[model samples]
Target: MKKEYKIGLSIIGLLLLVFTFTDMNISNAVYNPESKFGLIFEAIGEFPSAIIATFCTVSLMLTREKDKSIKYNLGTVGYIVLLIFFSLMASMIPVKYLHGPKALIPILMAIYITVSYVIAKKCATTHKEELRRAAIVGILTFIFVIIAFNSIKFLWGRERYRHMIEVGSFAGHSMWFIPQGFASGNEFMSFPSGHSANAAIMAWITLIPTFVTSLKDKKSWFIRFAILWTLLVPVSRIVVGAHFASDVTMGVTITLVIFTLLKNKYINNLEEKDAIHMFI
Candidate 1:
């Protein structure tokens, strides 16, 4: 592993450890509706993920050969435009009138994945290696992260922030404490956050091309954008009453760990010409 990667993971691990001990206090700090900032973050956190997926998928299609860059770039731009239009339209619908942001976003993500998969598969006729590897990483990242999060959630059986007696619930426990036999029968499944997991996966998805391009050519804007999205979504979930601080902290950490491991494996498998790990 690279020095930076190791250091990054270590920092995330430390934060996870610290948050595990202070989950309740942290949750309480942002739990108040009066905070007001969380509403803004929640409203925009998931904004451009599908557009990003489109960009990544399109970039994979425009491999070394095949002079289709113009068309693909235009297509990606069009996708972004449509995404912006839909987002504005969706915002017009009141939050109370909608079913669930969590559920709806995943459904949209699934659609984006399906579209990207089809495009990549079609373009694989010429750009086999790039498209295949990108798609494989993406599919695996999605499956592994979601499964890992839900598995822990099912086994941990922790309650959400508002559900705990700190806010208002008939039967509740301390959010900071983890106890034995805490593995089942809790209706709230809030130990680790699924929305935060989504944020991590989105970051990883966008990161694939960035890693494949050039380690030395790392784009600062893209890195900042990815980091901002990853930070905002999970925090929004915690503030909006869906998860506790520790839940999102652990969720993001687990997703990054899995994503980094998988990305490293893929980098290792590629030929020397495409070996990103060598430089890192």
Candidate 2:
């Protein structure tokens, strides 16, 4: 691991330790249901995931082609389909909160696709193998983070701070360590903040150094951005009473761990076979 990563992990460990004890207190102090800033963040929290999914999809599709003619093999097509599905699902998470015209969703998606295609094409043409590997690592990281956090959220079934506030009591509140398994609805899926987990996926920006040689020396900048975005989203979640400190911390931890492992296995380790290629 890099020295930066070591330092980053240490910070995360300290946060998890500190937040575990102060989770409820932090939420109680910061909870503001009507805060516009919190509402805005909550609405667009999934945008990072959508962008990552689109970028990976475009990268994989362009890099896998033999030529510019765009002939896609069955495996490539299947992967593209799956990535598009993930992208759409993520992008739609904020639609209900947008309170805008219905056309806004498609417009934003079009923009994502256009920008992703241009960037992916450039990388594909110049750094074919590197881009393909990065795309695979990114896609796997996104999928695994989603699955891990959501599964834990469902099984843990802790109530959201906001929901408790709405009901006028914390009597039903459960600690982060407790499993209240399979309760009523979305309110119960609060042990790990899905918004925080999804926001942490922005850390995928750090992987650009692995494929884009020009930005290799500037990796620390990207790392700082990732760290900033990750921390900011969790703060937003807490401010809006959507999650406690521990829930946000655990959510960020899930993505960071999964991303680090997959990045090491597929991007850093040259001898390792691509997981998708092994079967496809």
| TM-scores for all predictions | 0.64, 0.87
The window of 10 residues in a row where model 2 has the poorest summed lDDT is 65-74
Name the runs in model 1 displaced over 4 angstroms.
Answer: 33-127, 165-171, 174-187, 207-218, 271-280
TM-score, candidate number 2: 0.87
List clashing residue pairs in candidate 2: none
How many residue-pair clashes does candidate 2 contain? 0
Clashing pairs in 1: none
The number of the candidate with the highest lDDT is 2
- Over 126-172, each residue of candidate 2 has an lDDT whose tens digit, in order, gives 88888888898888888898889888887888999989889999898
Distance from true position, residue 255, model 1, in Å?
A: 1.2
Steric overlap count per candidate: 0, 0
Cα lDDT listed for each candidate: 0.62, 0.83
